[model samples]
Target: MTSQQHQRAAGKRAFITGAAGGLGSATARMLARQGAKVFLTDIDGDAVATVAADINRQAGEKVAWSAPQDVRDEANWERLLAEAALAMGGLSVLVNNAGIGSLGAIGAIELNEWRRVMGVNVESVMLGCKHAMAYLRDAQPASIVNISSLAAFKVDPDYTAYNTSKAAVAALTKSVAVECARQKIDVRCNSIHPAFIRTGIVKPFFDKLGEEEATRKLVRGIPMHRMGDPDDVAYAVLYLASDESRYVTAAELVIDGGARAV
Candidate 1:
């Protein structure tokens, strides 16, 4: 197709949260590989800087940048987005990939723990959209990819707080998406749901149970009989961030190994 008839650019200057490692780092690497300049951020300053450096080296250029951030703080969001946009020349994609998993039943979970989960998992996404919106709008046809979880739909009794937090993320994504669409802001928002990805967050389980035992236990609930790789969810985020999914918004892209199907 000629440039005149081609789709709008992917708006590839991307800002990714919780990008020190695991799914966040994987997503950042994938986007950079596909020619998107990425800014990586996480609570762990040194780790995120290392990941960004690795990406730049891999791409044979400076395709990635990084900063430290506490996603729960709205002030951090304001400051970080500005720095990211300036570094990348402009911002077009925002990936809210920071979240936590908790294992506690209703009465067993502490209120503080519940609040912590909500603050990091749900409120952070809200703060990101609220803060990065202007830059996204400026880079029209932009995208917001929030990393939720399959637990949002397939709730587990023991993980009530985590499930609830992810559910709220899905809802918030829709709210941002619809409002943007209604107001004709041209910025799209969506969420990703992945089950049992082999990220550092789940490393404790594997450590306690032994890799063999943990893999067996985790796969029992999954139809595919295996834990997902980081790239599994990374590809999904890449799709939502790219122009390929231009018509998609306020949607949940599941990256489970058909675990939810079971």
Candidate 2:
């Protein structure tokens, strides 16, 4: 089949966790625009509804749906998957994008903070894969695009907890791909590792540095000389979720604007 036909056939029903945030929301909109029926979700119930409503208002009916979900809770994962299947008739893509970011040195970070970050970032991806596997198995051709970070590869100090959680996501993505292949599940799993996307997490950090210094420091680090937009990461994710990346699995697609290399 032609590439356009492949993409059109493959990208259909997609559910995005953490759809209220920068990267997730952008990804949801991108997928919807590409003719996929998207489901948006977040821990914030109100924010989830607003995002879904806004996307639907702009995109029209059958374009989007929003639900409140705690990715750490397996039951919520199951419920959301069932709801998505009911709404869209089947599941073709799952974006495990829900995550919490924490900043601190390893020795200075509280144990509770470390656990909370891991619970949200690492466990949530695990739950998404676990609960969605059955439906994905039945669907045959499906993809799970996980949201990891550049920190998963290498990292500076003062982000110990966040770094560890993303590292786990990277590892988990590989493991999921291997297991699915072995089980003949006809599913693909991969992680997208991005660096310093202009998202809500950057606002407080920028506020601390007064924007100017923060911008300068970040631009200096990234060879692209600016913070990567969430749409950059979203498009990378949409590519993996679509048929364009059908041969790709257990891969880490890094959209860091050359930050990780430099």
Candidate 3:
């Protein structure tokens, strides 16, 4: 295809929440390399800018923009979209990857922590979908990849809040998929449920357990004896983000290394 044709079909503008950390940063980099103009946002201003800068340095113009955006606040989503329109032309893909990971058994869980996790993980995804649907619908062949957890389907009493929030996300994905189809919106949404990826958030937890013990403990019930990598999830994001999965929607792409299988 010619330059103009490529530009028109690229429609690769993306807004990735939680871009300052973990899987978000990994997916942002992967998307940028694949010709996307990425607008990255995080709650941490410095981290957000740092990741955007790193991507720009590595990929040049492909790295479009960056800012601090709190996913918990719907206002932030609106502002980010405005900025993304100017910086990257328009939004086509949204990676709702921002979430908190905290452990709390249901009975002893604090109300505030439970609300916070649900607000960030579940509400944030809903907000993104709510605000971006119009643009996404118009864009056609758009994608929204939400980051859920294996715990969404498989219960873990220790992390009740996180698990419940992800389960909501999974349910929301299905709801949105059906709505899009009913309305003929041309938008696609899916959830990615990952098991124990080696992101920084889990690093200290694993460190405390020691490598061998951590590995064994993580896979204690899982069939896979290894922890997942951010890239492992990133690749899954790319598959859904691209036209390769054009007909795929309302699906759960579990990147647990078959942990959830057994």
Which has the greatest TM-score?
A: 1
Poorly placed runs, candidate 2 (over 4 Å):
1-11
Residue pairs in collision within model 1: none
Distance from true location, Cα of 171 in model 1, Å: 0.6
User: RMSD, each candidate, Å?
Assistant: 3.1, 2.5, 2.7
Alpha-carbon error at 112 in model 1, in Å?
Answer: 0.9
TM-score of each: 0.95, 0.94, 0.94
lDDT measured at residue 176 in model 1 versus the true structure, 0 to 100: 97
| Number of the top lDDT candidate | 1
**How high is the lDDT of residue 67 in model 2?**
88
lDDT of 1 at 19: 97
Q: Kindly indicate the candidate among 1 and 2 with the higher TM-score.
A: 1
- Model 3 stretches astray by more than 4 angstroms: 1-10
Q: List the global CA lDDT of all models.
A: 0.90, 0.86, 0.85
lDDT string for model 3 (1-262, tens) is 1253333325577889998979999998888776778888888989989999988888655555889888988888888787887787777888999998889997989999988998999999999999988768766789999999998988889988988899999999999988998887778999999998988877777779987787788777767678888999988888888877889999999888787778
Ranking by TM-score: 1, 2, 3
1 or 3, which is superior by lDDT? Answer: 1
The local lDDT score (0 to 100) that residue 200 gets in candidate 1 is 95
The TM-score, computed over Cα atoms with residue i paired to residue i, of candidate 2 is 0.94
Judge candidate 3 against the unseen true structure and give its global Cα lDDT, from 0 to 1: 0.85
lDDT of 1 at 81: 94
